[model samples]
Target: MNLNELRDRAYKTACDHGFHDEELSNEHCLCLVISELMEAVEADRKGRFAKVPVDKKDTIFDERTFHYQNKYFAENFEAYIKDCVEDELADAAIRLLDLCGLRKIDIEDFTEEMLYGAEESCNDETFTESVYAISTIPIRYEYEYDYPLGGQLNSMLLAIFGLAKHLDIDLIWHINQKMRYNDLRENKHGKKY
Candidate 1:
């Protein structure tokens, strides 16, 4: 499916998982996204990757039990561990998509605009420079919009996309896989974070 379709699906998945049960403030959403990014950073630091338990019946998605059975990690454990950064990056995008869906933002359009802007900025600059430049795009919304957090949210989404590109991650596929795994979590990943 296309980006918009993916966004819709991501949003629906979040709702199905009870992420939309309460009205979260923009700052809260931003924090949630950032937390995922931090998790990615931590995963990278420890050379960790996302893995399913070998014994699916014994798996518990709760945070407390999530990492209790490293020995029973699924096959290709090494490869999956190496992909921790990418997995976390996908998670960040998933969070952003869910937020956009909740806010009724046209994420596909914004993503296109930001990506083009990033490309243009990279013509005479490094990728890092381009990302820094793109990060500033949210300033306009910060003051002009009633929901000032929109700017922050947009900036985070842009950065996530940029990182995904750098990491060669197919966010659509990762999001789909992550969501499917999430679905298998008890109560749809409820209280797991």
Candidate 2:
């Protein structure tokens, strides 16, 4: 699915699981996304990434292999996807997508080239620095009344995609998996959010 469709799907999953019982401000939503990014940083520092067995890596996310036991509960489970870098990045992106859906931020006109440009335009900063950049994007929203929140979110998303690309993470797959995982979770995904 394209970003818009993913946004819808993410938001729907969140709503079904009770994340939208009350409206949240732009700041609150952006903070949640930032929180996920911080989690990604923590995961990275600890050397936890989303690796499957070398043999099954390519097909690990396939429908038949998408079970939690295979993805996160297997023998080497802790060494892989549970709150790993890739998973947390997916969570960050999912949180951003969820916000887009809630705010009705229609990014249908945002082309792949636009995303490419956003990524290319970024400074060659460290991953943590890039996360810092993303964190700063939304803060400007509060002070810049004329600027659209969608623009900030789009920039934030590009940084996310860029980091995923740099780290060679199959972010889309993780997002799909996390969304499914979230679906099976309790209200508000068992969090107070």
Best by lDDT: 2
lDDT of each: 0.60, 0.77
RMSD of each: 8.2, 3.2
Return the TM-score for candidate 1, rounded to 2 decimals: 0.63
lDDT of 1 by residue, 22-109 (tens): 7778767767776777777676677664554434364443334434243332233334533476677777778887887788776544
Task: Predict model 1's lDDT versus the native.
Answer: 0.60
Instruction: Candidate 2: give its CA RMSD in angstroms.
Output: 3.2
On the 0 to 100 scale, the lDDT of residue 111 in model 1 is: 56
User: Which residue pairs in model 2 clash with each other?
Assistant: none
Instruction: Give a tens-digit lDDT track for model 2, residues 20-87.
Output: 99988988988899899999989888888876543454464456766664544343333457699988
TM-scores, in order shown? Answer: 0.63, 0.83
In model 2, the runs with Cα more than 4 Å from the true position are 53-60, 67-79, 108-112, 118-123, 141-146
Error of 1 at 69 (Å): 23
- For candidate 2, the 10 contiguous residues with the lowest summed lDDT are 70-79
